[model samples]
Target: MKKLSVSILYAILSVAPIAGAQGDIAAQVVPQVLSRSPEEIRPWRAPVFADQSAALGYNESAFSIPKGMEKQVQFWIDVYTKYTTEQGVIHDAENVETVYEIVDLKGLKTEREKQKKVDEVKKIIAARLSTPEEGERLRFQLGQKDRMQDAIFYSGRYLEDMEKIFRDSKVPVELTRLAFVESSFNIMARSKVGASGIWQIMPYTARPYKMISPVVDKRNHPLEATKLAAKLLRQNYSMLESWPLAVTGYNHGPTGVLKMTKSYETRELGELIQNVRSRKSFGFASRNFYASFLAALEVEKNANKYYGSVVWSKPLPAQDLKLPVSVKYKEIVSWFDGDDSKAQVYNPHLTHKARKGHPIPAQTVISVPKDKYNVALISLARKDRTVAMEDKKGR
Candidate 1:
């Protein structure tokens, strides 16, 4: 039997990992597909999970963790994250482009040419992987070790909220796994293009999901953003009808995905990825979005397999407080020991004024720490009394 190199396999699919927060090429054979006739060797049908757990199982059995598809996912995450962290706001992150270039460069038949190309690539990169150790660290960052351990930690802390939100939106709970692809559940993760929060929602997309900002961007609020993610994803699924396409649309816009799905007359995600990437409007980011998700899902599903044991983050304990009217930031913070940043953290959906300790619009829903529940309520009541007193005196 003839063996196919990992790079060759990735080339056919254009399977670079998702852009920032999502990631590229590494190896693990898809035996069933690999053994097939030349015509049969493309990404198999995208799995439609019965539930969140089953979808995760597909990620594991189908794509092994460390050496599996997740390794590629980790690759992109490390590459892109490294760029953004080091360069500080990479407007056009070149991680995806670099992967494509690497594939093409490797195709150069001569070792001397490839060496020359490697030097060229190295001089351009901020994170120097010149040493084997540096390359290993990049891979190891998300590869089934300490970094994935962090993923497992955040997963424990936030998965319940994600599942509940998805359930409420009437979408498949498994969709929660996309966070592993988007931001690695790092709530603070921000892409250069302003894809914010754990789900990496762009500002424009958030508006359609009833998320607005300059006050509060719910994207940074884990619980609220997860809910919005479910709604946005549900809308995508409703439009696309295919789970795979729906998931792909989450990374790329649904309208474009819908157009390709119709024009191509097939819903095979693998084919669509290959075809769409060739278009002038599209690129590797969208092409490999699903694969990136698959990689994260695979690693997340088989956490114990890669690491000896996982320590999960504790579930968030908080209460939703709906302000009866527009409330001053002072009033909100008064309830929580006058810490302004706490308001920002809990009420991430606030506008700039409210987020920065100014008055927020009435009827805003904010998350408050459960431990401070009574104090918050009392503070609000006190504000109401003070307002009434002032009105009485004026009368």
Candidate 2:
């Protein structure tokens, strides 16, 4: 099959969400879900990997937390999963990019009241135990702009392709949402810790996946990166033999999460995260990654409540084209309409030099307008000699 690269990140923005009283929106899930501690929350189980495979035990009934740990799991899921909306905070599970600020800056009014509300918000975040400093920085907020809406709109653009890749790899298609938790579908997202792209892939994961590094991180290419991620996720699932652990392993790494499970000899993922919360390696992001996925999944399943209503972006009509050889921009423009910037837009992964007369790696595949395939193919077939040898080296 000839895979041609095509840009598919286009989106159609809808009208701003309906205006409503901040209290009205915040009242939906904030107080009940946020204020409740692990002890107060009930243990509940949800199906996993049900979209495709079940042999891994995900096909079985919902799996709830072990006794005495429901609240702990629920706490992380709610806070970590919740994003700020214009009305109130909501879970990514709701499928809407809504955020709610606290109407009351709980600890700002008076010293006593401030500390009391600060403690309450702290408890919701569990930062009281983990990073109490966040609570101090966190004021009670009621309404805020839903910044994630644009990202969510873009998510509709690539999610289908991602799921197709997952299906082909025999990994659970539902893992597509992991991108939402990772980088909110931001194609160019980068982390201070060095993770990048839609999957927020770190340097270590990037190397094994064969992505171009530093200057040309293929991790930014959603479709290619997702394929690599699915394979990694599938391998993790095989090693850990637990869906939750495998999902968390994407963030914490399979070796450590597997070690965590072995240390306690319990396959219960919630138990593992809860137990290892204070470990040097098992920091907040790692501890909460899997549960946060669950939280997002839950809200997504119930998009009406969280998002109110969502508009999806149509998938881009595109085809992939592989470079026959590493050629410079002048050569590519001969094939494109003599517009270098237009050619660059079609292939975002190309380094600046590649667009400015440097050789585009022969192994590189670029997405082009669907109609441009034949033209690109003919142009490449008729031109340069094969850089097949260099392609393997680059890969």
Candidate 3:
């Protein structure tokens, strides 16, 4: 009995110690039940307690915040300052109220400054563009009574067409009368210095617009040249953006108009006219364009009272055509000039009675009686296409 008791005691001692060791190991593996709160468990990276609690939930220890990053951390607080109701929530932080007030004041100031800039831009654009007074002055120029009877009589033909051109361009209808003072509506009108056509297009200026070709200076063709003239006027209007400058430029070229613009400084059309210093440069003709337009208006207002409407009513319409010019001048003259007459209606600049020494230039689009000669002239034009190319130097 004693031996059995001794064996049992040995087993109990050995197994009991082993069991105790296992219990000790289990106690070490179990997580510790700490008394510290979630916020207290981790150092605050953010000032907010919620952020610290999130850190604690993740079982983190001391937070590894970046050095010298206090401002960065406070920035989030500043952004969400309204949400923070706790007293002393952002001690030593930016004064959010002051910052927001300053920002609002700055926005107001910026808007005022922006409005000022917008007003300035509007003033600049207004000065550059058209104005009512300018329109009135131009009207006066068209309504002038100088060269009264003859001016109106001669201009009657082209004035009708110019009216249509100006109307299409939205330029005042009265300004069309300047064609009388410029070219007398005669397509063949040439200045002593060689400016030609109704618009008085100078050779140098007309060359660039392709108004003058080797065989033909289309500046003499009223419809063709007027189309080019309108294009040039539109371009000038874009730059100076004034009808006055545009009209002056039509007479004096763009460079001349630009000089006037610079001399005046301000782009006001009235100022430009008022400050006119030269009679030769931006002088008499340019100055008189407005006067001429005014005169034209007066004539138009009382067309029948001054000059009968018959001549004005019968003014030729502007026609646009890609004329097939192939017939030699001799052939064209034979077809158009009845009874072997040498007179050519189209190019008045051409030497009369064209002979072998002065061979008739081909492809010449003679603006004859529109309906009467169109078919016959067209058939003759197809005969000498090569001759048109041969005499390219005369023009």
Candidate 4:
């Protein structure tokens, strides 16, 4: 198989490890500090930081970092906050805390050159493991740092709306931060396996929610995608009854997670990850899904501390108008006084066919600028009536 890019490695999908990265490498142990009390380790406990009230825009107590997984979570936190996209960490796959080196790929002219460098590091690590002096075996992993600053900046457009959707759906509003892990809040992000949008939902997963269709693929629309994601997460939680498992279920299917729970005879996420046999189905991505989420949550909540004084984009202001009749994309733009750019911005969900003069189906909720909503609605009504009269005359 071809080498996976660093960006592809971090997406919420189970991809193969980089080429020539052998298993059974040695782990370089790293020390960790345990600050929280045993009682406070529970997932439902209140925020550890007292000053940032409503820090995540929800009940901050619902999701805590699992005890044994703190190092893993911290590793991801560094990936998001400390490192940039130009750098990647070469580490033990199973033992994530045992990072061997941080490779700087900034000067590499091409992806092939970068992969060559990564493969060389992997071979050296594998050779060390082969030596009797190392005396331990491990699998190698390449961890890519996210473009978190950009993610956080883009998140400003939909964060409040996402929180509201999750809140109204009765799902944990903090789960909205999953976008940071999945696609770094990049609206146009599309995974190799066909997961799309800020939520990174697969087509199969989105079909039931009616999020993918001929006229529009709501998976690319931040707010619409959030509504579906909230519902899917709520269902997963309802089934698994554990936020860790439910969130993991977002990346690995809930059914697969349910099987792992049964196989391991435990609902404790840390235990399952530690004990379950790694395979093609439930590998690194599934194991680290929740840890990455916790990492994202912590990093995003304390964004200012990590990234000094971020100026977030304002929430887009628009009104949703349910169409009374099928209308072409240009017609909608006409209603917006021919500001095609603004019309496109407000309707990111429109598919290529819809944009190519095809009529958007009736009853579709079209977003229009809040200020222009009244006039747009009037214009649409007038156009619909005129079309009806023309059809009657033809008949």
Task: Judging by lDDT against the true structure, name the best candidate.
Answer: 4
Question: What is the Cα-based TM-score of model 3?
Answer: 0.49
TM-scores for all predictions: 0.64, 0.64, 0.49, 0.78
Q: What's the C-alpha lDDT at position 299 in model 1?
A: 53
Per-model clash counts, in order, read 11, 30, 20, 2
Regions of candidate 4 where Cα sits further than 4 Å from its true position: 1-61, 131-146, 276-280, 333-343, 371-375
Candidate 1 lDDT, tens digit per residue, 265-287? 86767555445343445455675
| Local distance difference test, each candidate | 0.54, 0.54, 0.41, 0.67
Q: Which ten residues in a row have the lowest lDDT in candidate 3?
A: 1-10
lDDT tens per residue, model 2, 87-170: 233222111222223334422544354445534543565443245543333323232224334445556557767877887787
In model 3, the Cα lDDT at residue 139 comes to: 10
Alpha-carbon RMSD, each predicted model? 14.6, 11.8, 44.2, 10.1
Displacement of the residue 36 alpha carbon in candidate 4, Å:
39
Candidate 1 stretches greater than 4 Å from native: 1-17, 20-146, 276-279, 338-343, 392-395
Which portions of model 2 show Cα errors greater than 4 Å?
1-51, 54-57, 60-147, 213-216, 276-278, 329-346, 374-395
